[model samples]
Target: MIDAIKTFLVKIKDQGHVLPLIHQADIQVNLHCDQQIIQLNIKNGGILFLQNLDGQQVKYEISGSPTAMKQLFEGTERLRVLEQQGQLKASTPLRTTLLLESIFFLTKAQNS
Candidate 1:
């Protein structure tokens, strides 16, 4: 999982280098497994660069405290409960719900 995150970050950095035309930013995602709290703190240093519509290259940084992380995990746990039932029946509804809940986190990270 850590490797995957590193790979994703590297890929995004490479994209920023290639484009040099879109707003890019980075934040340190401090994930506390014990508390299940995800704190995203924008750092003093980041690699993302941007060139806006006027063709002005600019630096970018992203800072956010998106509080929906806990809610997202709770929704997933609800679905997990159903999956833990004796009858292991997999259906589209279950899959869709998981997908949607996952989007809440993914989109939050991407947009931030």
Candidate 2:
């Protein structure tokens, strides 16, 4: 499923019309696990920091644009809403905090 999602995102980005969405954005996804923060060097400088709280693991995936990513962390209840709305699906206590660190990264990073 991850592979499928990646392929789809890549295709969407390759389309000239959609590419403009993040022409100046970059993203980095940092997975804080194993007692360390794993940093991913996004090619376009886009960064996504995902901190999954212990005891929770998601079954489905929650996806959005860079702007939407930053907004999801406004409060704790918002996370719950995402799950309930089928945006984020997890069986454990997975808490996520998203941060936008650069303007060169976009969905292109993950999609590519």
- Please name the candidate that would achieve the greatest lDDT relative to the true structure: 2
Candidate 1 wrong stretches, greater than 4 Å: 17-28, 33-41, 44-112
Whole-model lDDT values for every prediction: 0.32, 0.36
lDDT score of residue 76 within candidate 1 = 28
* lDDT digits (tens) for residues 29-97 of candidate 2: 442322443333334423233343454443333454333333332222344455466554333324222
For candidate 2, the 10 contiguous residues with the lowest summed lDDT are 95-104
Per candidate, the number of residue pairs that clash is: 0, 23
* Clash list (residue pairs), candidate 1: none
